[model samples]
Target: MVLTAPSPKIRRSATKVALVVGSVLNLINQGAAILGPADISWVHVALNFFVPFCVSSYSAARN
Candidate 1:
């Protein structure tokens, strides 16, 4: 009998999906810019840092 592990390609695909979803969320946040104050743009910039930290931590905890 033999056992096999998941391949690197599968891991890379999952990472790509996460990045795409994160980018889409960022775009949605940016698209809301016109409705808020001048500083609202800062929120989108902040998410660049915030989102990855949050997602990484959450994923780490799940493992």
Candidate 2:
């Protein structure tokens, strides 16, 4: 099946949710690196937020 882009409202909502959830997840998953001198995995950090945003937007679009 083909997929279309989600609406602006859905994208905005998904972004809000992603930011909140992703921040919590990042803090939990990489607190040491974030709060210390250790190197942080930038890719992993982006995915953590992006995955949630995609999931939210997809679900909204499906509905």
Candidate 3:
């Protein structure tokens, strides 16, 4: 099947989901770097948010 971009509304909803889920995950997975003396990996942080966003968007688009 051909893939297509999700609509703006779906994208917005996905983004919200990603923000909440990703933040919680980051807090759990990278709390030390976030709250203590450690170097934060920007790539990992971005992926944490991005993965959820993509999952949400894909699910919405599929239905």
Candidate 4:
């Protein structure tokens, strides 16, 4: 069997894409809270920061 390694450029590009997507989702979640009912704001807050932080940390560690 042969093993292939990913190039550094590819790794960096993937990381950047992940970070951008996470950031966009985070922003959307936060924005949603502005128009949503007060009771649902907490949920948005949690999703906005918690999920992104977890994904970002994992991506950073991988790099």
Ranking by lDDT: 3, 2, 4, 1
- Clash pairs (backbone) in predicted model 2: none
- What is the RMSD of candidate 4? 7.4
> Candidate 2 local accuracy as lDDT?
0.86
For model 1, the local distance difference test gives 0.54
- Please name the candidate that would achieve the greatest lDDT relative to the true structure: 3
User: Which residue pairs show backbone clashes in model 3?
Assistant: none
> Model-by-model lDDT, in order?
0.54, 0.86, 0.87, 0.55
Off by over 4 Å in 1: 1-18, 32-40
Q: List the residue pairs that clash in candidate 4.
A: none
Q: lDDT tens string, model 1, 8-61?
A: 544454456557766676667665664555345676656654566456545544
List residue ranges in candidate 2 displaced over 4 A. 1-4
lDDT score of residue 7 within candidate 1: 40
Worst 10 residues of 3 by lDDT: 1-10
Top-scoring candidate (TM-score): 3
RMSD of each: 7.5, 1.9, 1.8, 7.4
Per-candidate total of colliding backbone pairs = 0, 0, 0, 0
The candidate 2 region of ten consecutive residues with least summed lDDT is: 1-10
lDDT of 4 by residue, 1-63 (tens): 012124455446556765676568756755655566534456655565556555655555565
